[model samples]
Target: MDQYKLFLQRMGLIGTSTFLVTITGIMLLPILTQNLSIQDYGVWTQFQITITIIPAIAILGLPYTMVRFLSASKSRTEIQEAFYSILFTVIFASIMGAVALYILVVPISHVLFNGNVGVGLILPLTVIMSALQLVFVDYFRASNQMTKYAVFTTLQAYMVVIFALLLVLMGRGVVGAVTGILITQTLISLIMFTFVLKQIGFKIPRFHNLRQYLTFGLPTIPSNASFWVLDASDRYIIGIVLGITSVSYYSAGYTISSLLTILTSPIYTVLLPILSQFYAERKIRETRFLLNYAIKLYLIVAVPAVIGLSILARPLLYILSTPTLANQGYLITPILATGGLFFGLYCIITQIIVMERKTKITGNIWAISAILNIILDVTFGYFLGIIGIAIITLLLYLTAFLITVYYSLNYIRCDFYVKFAKKTIYAAFFMALSLILLNPYGPVNIVLSGLFSFALYIFVLWLLKGIKTDEIKFFTGMIKESLVNVYCALRGL
Candidate 1:
């Protein structure tokens, strides 16, 4: 129980951070969509997708490797060597990636950036800084420094949003937004590097563990690339097939749907390091327990979120973006929300494969799924437009979830709490029905209806006994303890 509480506390910290970031995104979405032209927004979206993919490829999954190996290390010397070795390797690879991006800037600008040479030129530097930022941030995760991790994560989001909004408001447009990102990345990287250096001290690594780290981390590159394909390739396909304007519509919908990730992201962040520690100690039962409960907790939030977001998609999008975007992109939300739910589940379950160090299997699964996703994206995107892309994405996520479940079970069994899931769905159905009857139109009504609907859902779930007393007590206790900690910190200051 104590261990579970500790896990929840850490998760809550990161979860709070993620929630703030999500709110920042929600606030920024309107500002960007309203301020920028649809075509320019599409360019911005393309730039984001490109940066995400490049860093995922360039960092070589070494950050995660650090989490896996360093979670259990107590030796300061050993930690120093592994950290420096991985950091240096990632830096070298990222620079090489930046050079490659610079060399290929012209064609990439044409294909993705809509021939914006300035954004293309800025891309290489952004990729390098972004890659370094990733490594530095994961250093905290590797060391179980959730407070620092959460603070930096939230800080970076706000910084980027503020900088970009200021630049865009000054009539700098998509290029300004891209430049804002580069500036924020560079500053955050420097800050994080300084803090981490102070904590771990500096060491010149012998690269003794470099081979082992690569052996573990390299296979995950395919998985990471495949994931980017599943998640972001649709933008490219839509941009190519329909037009950059259409990409804006698709991306707007995708952004609204990705709210589900706010629930899953913290779980992934907190789960990995702790799970690594448990697996290293051969605590299989604890590992299974944690995984099972994590999925259940995620579903508790996510199941209703999917339904609520789908039901409120139009109003939410209308409030956040233009009416035209709301109308064209609203349908994409339900499909993507459902798909995101499945993908979130896959992320939690696939930890078992990671624990077993069978990263090759994970890579194989995503590699196959990515190929299928692209083929479907081209066919369906051309014929059925963005809706078809959404449907295929849902199918791919579901397939991945099913396949991962199969492979994951071979190593450790986890209960998915089918009855609890049914209750959640039942509660969500009623919430959706209420939302439909109310028919929220504007931002204020939408906010009210959303709050009322969520409260009602909780009430209904409680009546159905889906939420047990002990579970409620546990979370409330954790919250109270967190409040006390905050109060003490403030008092100290």
Candidate 2:
């Protein structure tokens, strides 16, 4: 169908961006790891984790409203109105957040940082830029401008990498690193963000649609707050309890491992607006199909990816990280990958929940999940060093997937847990079995072991007939279409 083609096109664009980002990361990280000191890098990472705390306040749940509201708008005029309202909201919040940061800089600085007050000045700018960027991003996504959205995200990433490298080589140190992020975001907001926003038609925020936006947004503030709380509380608490060095190790480990999330995150970004619209139109079959298919694709890729990362974590740490990070990275990689898989599943399920306007339900799930994260992260961080913390975070995410699936099953089909296990488990098991058979002894052997494992996994999938009958049909159809298209190109069809 045309729709399926469109989805593939969107997926390709987004996938390209993801790949570019991964490559950029592969290039940028070694330089950063080699250049920066562990404590300074840790402090730098604290800044990174700390910023997630702001959107909870500054965007103030506007993202959730923007996705749901702007996606459902039918008329161009109505969508325009929503964009203006959101723009005004972004600007207003930016100013307020900046001012609040100015006010709270001293007291909270002492409390959180124990007198290292410079992070205070950095907070306001980062929060403002983040606020503007979130609104800009959400607006574009809600408008279904996938190609431009994809380009913007890609360029923004490249810009960050370039700037960070420039800053570091200039000897600006940690401040330079943070400056790179601030500069990239601000430039995007000024250049691409505001312009494309105007193309969709700009107006000042008006009273008419304003109430609906706020009505939709306000209740979820605490729910979103819970996410911020859960994310930052661990870092902040660790910084406080385990010392800044602990924060640094944890931060570095998390930063390196979180590239997996960054790569996969955009797929969810592409799916949400489209999914919301499908749900709004009551296209139940298509919606259910995507939901199931996404889950299947995630399991297929994520399982092997997780195992492979766990297998490679020790060497990956040695190659890509500093002494502090290398030590922590080996332990963190698998745990983070496992958690990342769960989070990916949660995103698909949560999109279903969001589409159904069951945000309150989703919120409660996040809240309980956040609490679990806190208890486990704190307990683990305290008793077992950071590995314990890592495991706890992974467990919480898996738990959330379970909770979300339990709640959102009515909105989807193809019991994914069943489909996933039957399709992939035996295949994956055979892959692991291949590693035992080969019995490679060194890093080259280990690398070969992973390669053989993947080959066996694919082979078993072929043998079991579990690659989804639809996938074969789709591939064959694609080949046929390609030949026809080539003929048409020759004949000017």
Candidate 3:
């Protein structure tokens, strides 16, 4: 019980911090649309897609290997050795990746930007910065340093908004925005690297157990790359087939939908090492219990999030984007939200494979799914346009979820709580019905509608026995404790 409370506290800290960052990002969307030209915004989006793909792919998955190995390392010396060795390996990979991007900027620019070479020059720095930052953040997670992790994660979001927005306002366009990100990330990476070295007591990284690290991390390269393809390649297809404005519209909806990750990712960070240790100790019952509880809790939020976002897509987009986008792009939200739901579920279930060290299977599955996603994106996108792209994304995510869950079951089985899911669906249907009837527009209406919908959802869920008494007690206890703490602080303790 104590351990469970500690876990919840840590998750609460991480989740709350990440929620602030997510809200800041959501706030930035309308500002960017209002300031930057659609073409420039499209360019910025493409650059973002590059950084996301590069860091996830270029580091050779060493960050993940670090989490797996460092979690189990016996001695302090072993920990330092594993950390620096993986760190240096990634540093070298980043440099090589930067050089390759610099050399091949021409052809890539041609594909993405109709031969706009300035933006391509920014890739090298962006790639290296992204890689180093990712390594450090994962290092924080592996070391169980949630405070440091939350600060840096939130800092990155703020830095991008401040620097990038200022530059875009100054007429730097895509180049300026990309440069702002590059500069901010480089600075943060340096500071984080210094902190890591101080904590770990820097040692010159060697090849100690390098092969083992690569053995665990290398196969994940394809999986990471494939997941990138599944998520980001649609932007490219939209750019090539429809043009930049359409890409801007598509990406806006995608961004809003991606907010669903705010609920899943923090829990994911908390879950990985815990489950890894559980599996390592052969605590099969505990692992299964955690997995079932996690799925239920995640769905408790995510199911309603999907339904609410779908019902409120238009007004939400209006509030977050330009009028043109609010009109045309609103439809993409529900699709991406649904896709995100599947993707989040996949993230949870795929832990079985990771814990079992059957990562090669993940790579194979995502690879096949990536191919299918690309084919569908290009085919349906060309004929049917952005709407087709949205549908394809949802379908691909569902495909990945089904395939992963099937294989994950083969490895280690756990109950999925079908009864709980049915109750959630029942509650969500009533919420959707209410939202449709309210049909909110503008800010005040949306807020009122949201409050009503939320209360109705909870009331319906409680009536349906979807939310159990014990679950309610658990949350109420936490809330009461929080209020008492606040009161004590106010009274100067």
Sort order, TM-score high to low: 1, 3, 2
Query: Which 10 successive residues of model 1 have the least lDDT summed?
Result: 484-493
201-229 per-residue lDDT for model 2 (tens digits): 56555657777667667656655665354
Q: Number of backbone collisions per candidate, in order?
A: 0, 1, 0
- Looking at model 3, which ten-residue stretch has the lowest summed lDDT? 484-493
Colliding pairs, model 1: none
* lDDT for each residue of candidate 3 in 238-304, tens digit (9 for 90 to 100): 8988898898888878777777878877778878877877788888888888888789888888898
In order, the Cα lDDT scores of the candidates are: 0.88, 0.69, 0.82
In candidate 1, which residue ranges exceed 4 Å CA deviation? 477-493
- Which lDDT tens digits does candidate 1 get at residues 290-376? 999899999888988999889998888888999899899898999999999998998899889988889988888878887888899
TM-score per candidate, chains pooled: 0.97, 0.87, 0.94
List candidate 3 segments past 4 Å from native. Answer: 476-493
TM-score of 1: 0.97
